[model samples]
Target chain A: MNYPNGSKQIPRSSQKLNSNETIFSNRGMTLEEDINATNDYYLDACLAVIHKKPTPVQIVKVDYPKRSAAVIKEGYFKQASTTDYNGVYRGKYVDFEAKETKNKTSFPLSNIHQHQVNHMKAVINQGGICFLIIRFAAFDETYLFQAHHLFEHWDNQFKGARKSIKYEQIRENGYFIPFAYQARVNYLSIVDQVYF
Target chain B: MNYPNGSKQIPRSSQKLNSNETIFSNRGMTLEEDINATNDYYLDACLAVIHKKPTPVQIVKVDYPKRSAAVIKEGYFKQASTTDYNGVYRGKYVDFEAKETKNKTSFPLSNIHQHQVNHMKAVINQGGICFLIIRFAAFDETYLFQAHHLFEHWDNQFKGARKSIKYEQIRENGYFIPFAYQARVNYLSIVDQVYF
Candidate 1:
């Protein structure tokens, strides 16, 4: 079936969900599916090459039921040491974490881990574009908040600053991702506006 | 304990295997370990931000015995669709696969999968740097062969060309990665020569 850009075939996993369905059920579509579809669109157009890192799993034991396939009998989820999505956009490194909140008023700082904040700092220090994609699921709005802005709030938290960032603050500092027909979450346009 | 790059502390996992051990047993050090150490050195020196993608696993069942932890009860390995290593180097996307051969005659083409070749092609098409790090273990020589050159050989195979690339062809076409005290496998230096 034809996808967003209609240039590349739909990914096997995302074949069941189409842009039309996503548009009709915007609230039902998870932020991840939207981003994944958007990434597929970007990839088809050769605009950027970004990918969400696979969830890390720590294996404890394995059983070799067959010579070719070894089954993991025991394992646990491991805390990721870096951001969810990262890649190159227009010959520049891009890194960011995607998160969503049901709360319409504020985004809780507790949703982000300390290590991830440190990782984004490292990426930014090394001259890479780093940011956070904050989605207010209740309002069906998503914003791209730069890492520097995120750091300012994160640093103040240790000095008794508010543990959550008000939605108004995000709206003020972040760029709104325009929802589009082909590109559901058109954040790269904002990346071009800010970074270019 | 000090690592090869004395600037950075030894990684927790590699603390047991110090530089001295790696140096003394160069033959014993797996290509994966060498590349990991090299990547760590690059990261510590702020030269590059590259990483090996985690082995993908397909989880079948999970048991949450505690509120804090979830144990995976059943899982299986999932074949990766891209190169093993990818990251940003000097604001450009870099993707590569590392392979080692005990064979003195030729590097076998069978070692690489078709999907990885396609992935590298896509990366290159999007203005990214993609290559292969082929190590002839017996000679302790590693070479950075660009994906284009690898592709030429790979494509010609179907037209009655050799199934494996000769060591002499690689020696002629690929840049040699100098062995170093700090970087262990100094492939980036060759990257500087070829790409920069």
Candidate 2:
């Protein structure tokens, strides 16, 4: 079966969602894959522009096999210097990080790195639209939290207010990113309501 | 010498440049290092905000040596889906790709792939700034050409234009990115000149 170049294929993999099905059993889709499909749909519909940050790798050895795709035999992961998913929407720069949490009640700071926090701050400083799309998978809910609010809590992280943001706090601070059949994570609608 | 963390010190390797040595003996500075230093200066001086796209990778195996850091034991290079550099400059969103060409006469279409071309077109369609920076190493000349021109040439590939863009044609259609001691590529100067 063609995976449709994105994670949406999980739903299309079979007519029924069952515990035994690999698609149903394996979290169905990762946050990254969902965002990828969402971006593809956005590109197709011309609503807004965004793309996932590339995986950071240090290429050490490349194998050139004739009549086949070049296989990277050896490489190392490099630290990312910026946040993933950035582009323009209605003339405003849109930048964000997508994260999923198994916890039903909160989003964890441990799930984020300091570098990512700093990168989002930098994006906000540049007159760009910056936010975080967080998914509480257990609750099957996603929230769009603006960078300023995220940093506010992050600033208080040293004081140990909360390691992860509570669902209640997120509900107060973030806009709900409604899911659609075509655009799975339609955060731009929230962006239009908030940043734009 | 410190080589961006985790890279072992190889005992004054022959390829190691003096602190001030230019890279490839043509661009005056390695693209990665110069982009970092330029970003540092940009952050310090509050100039237009721009950054090099993070290196892309696919992590296959990772060892959690300590909670603070994960040692990536195995990974592969994933094809990049976007340009090499992008950010917000003033109020405009900026995005671009940087490439070095050995061919002195023309830039080849083989250097770019379909996905990247689609990404650039999407960025432009969203009203963001997009372009490519080409370094003709033989002549030590750098040129910034808009993605539209690239798309046009690439589209014409089916109609049977030259497979590559001539250096003379590039000179006519593209702007020469000024060399700078600090910024190196200094492509933003040309952005201001052309776009602003």
Candidate 3:
């Protein structure tokens, strides 16, 4: 499909969509797609106003054609200083990052960055709800792990602890997010339970 | 200055800064630079956690060289579907759009998009503090116009009303944001007065 700007969509192998099936049943859908669909549902339902931030890019050069849109000729992605998703839910500020791991036993700390952890710490310090959405794709299980819980594990690694959070530990400490037809990754349910 | 990605900063005439003076006295600074500086101050002061969302880009092609980072070879900017700035303040959700106009008599409705208006309305409905930071560059004056006030002017344009809001009307309805040494566009003071 082509965007309004005349640029065609760059299809990713994991994001292939089948016309016959609903997004909720599209088992091959990546974690980002599910969360975006879920956020759209939440917006339409007036439950929340969350959105995935666009990828940050550093533009080096652009060419403005006579009558068409300006095209970026050179650009590079920048590391995001904040989380992937944030919004207001029930009059409360919410912020979170989502990650998908194929590893069967653990969610690696390498999936996150120190700057992101610092950002989340600042969010929590300001009284906002902050967390991570970790999806173990092999088991099709997604868990909502609060930021404070992740921080403890994050700091422990610097003290010679394991570099990843074990799946069993996540299962014990994080809330499991269930899939729904409308809200594919229904994380707000977990937010409602833990925050409110 | 060159970014970490090796992309040199594109010189914007209005954003040129002198090494001799602080940003507060940089009269030529655009509204965006002022707001960004203000946000940085707020972050360091532990007062707020707001950020301007990155410009959305529809990347069409990327080149991943052997040793360096991926380079976007072709891309087009996409219109954002939400307001520019958003974050948490005192545990409350805050969202806004910033626009600078050279018009002396009025602020044109065309400065904003319909989708942004819809997004702001949704945010207000969710009890988030939503507003517009309007700067009259000609007057060197800025005002924090609440989203609901903007909605009236926005909807009236479709009902055979003026296509722009009169300067006098904005002066009456919007809170004037005073410039400060640290907070160039000190809008949170208006938020504290109006919402808190």
Candidate 4:
């Protein structure tokens, strides 16, 4: 039930698509699950109000049954224009995307979208705390890489530079988020240390 | 193309389901559209980073082709647990729901869901700027009613109080958001006035 990172594995039998169970621990405690648990802990303690934006769906056809909620018979998942999670922390705007990579030496740029990069820039320009929660899944390590740092590497990609950030570079520039018991990923502590 | 409240109706011919057009002008520029335009203007000016949460959907079936993106074949609308619009403004967590009522005397409690009330309470308890943007369509009037003021009346509903908050009460407690040329609803200016 528990992973090496101290995250509890939620039972697959209890996974429900319509519920918060999307972030449950069945297929290895994904970086998302730990963050969700952390957000829940934060919410319970009145710490912050961060939430993962719901997956966007384009509804095409609907069946209006007799006296029942309308059922969408056809739809398509649409790519999100912003980051995965966003909210307020200590009276500051907090926004970030969580990405997992099994690659050992680097975090790939292709994992992120152009609009997401633009969104981070907008948030930063608006004086918000924006970053990337990069999980090197194979090594069980997570880092809070600031949006500006990511932007540097992203901009270099246009000049035929490396399409990924070296692990060494990330270790130097990014703040490591320690895996904790109740706090799970413990990224906000890094946010406080880095931003505050 | 302009509604009575100064919101511009997005041309129906240009509406796209998967686009932000869902929040665009139509139906005489619903309050949602005006707010969306204001949010867009704010984003462009690097003022704030507010966004309306996408409508939640419970996807039941999806199809994956060899070369294309996944397509959701069946889904159903899911009632949201939180407010419709939320983001960061002036380094503070800002959240609110926009509602329009034709009733001239009072804003009906039935217009809001119990879960939404609970969500607002949670945000306010955590030090967020929470409120309601209620528009009286018939009167061409709008008010930014704070969540705490709304909660007082909501709690009273269980103790045999009236099912609606009278317009006079809203006029006394809520800040009026003026319609502006470029920003549409100009709610953030009201936010700046009230909170900053």
Q: Write the per-residue lDDT of candidate 4 for residues B54-90, one digit (tens) a residue.
A: 8999888888988987878778888898898987776
Please write out the lDDT profile of model 1 over residues A1-196, one tens digit for every residue. 1122323432222346555664333577899999999998988888887888878999999999755689899998999988888777777778899999999799999999998998787687677888999898877777889999999999999999999999889878887776778788888877877887
- Please give the DockQ score of every candidate, comma-separated: 0.47, 0.34, 0.66, 0.47
Q: What value does the interface RMSD of model 1 take?
A: 1.6
- With a 3 Å backbone cut-off (N, CA, C), the pairs that clash in candidate 4 are A91-B91, B10-B25
Q: What is the TM-score of each candidate against the true structure?
A: 0.85, 0.78, 0.88, 0.84
Report the TM-score of the second chain of model 3 against its true counterpart: 0.87
Q: Candidate 2: RMSD over Cα atoms?
A: 10.4
Residue-by-residue lDDT tens digits, candidate 3, B1-196? 1111222322222256667855444369999999999999999999999999999999999999999999999999999999999999989999999999999899999999999999999998999989999988887778888899899989999999999999878877887776678998888877876788
Q: What stretches of model 2 exceed 4 Å from their correct place?
A: A1-27, A59-74, B1-37, B58-76
Give a tens-digit lDDT track for model 2, residues B1-196: 1121233322111345678875433345555565567667776667766777765766777667655555556555567877777788776888887778889789988888888898888888889899988877776767788899899999999898878888877878887665566666666777776777
Q: Top lDDT: which candidate number?
A: 3
lDDT of 4 by residue, A116-196 (tens): 999888788777789999988766777889999999999999999999999878878887676567788888777876788
Ranking the candidates on TM-score from highest down gives 3, 1, 4, 2
Q: Give the distance in Å from residue B70's predicted Cα in candidate 3 to where it truly belongs.
A: 1.3
The alpha-carbon RMSD values of the candidates against the true structure, listed in the order shown, are: 8.4, 10.4, 10.8, 9.7
Clashes of each: 0, 4, 0, 2
DockQ of candidate 4 (2 decimals): 0.47
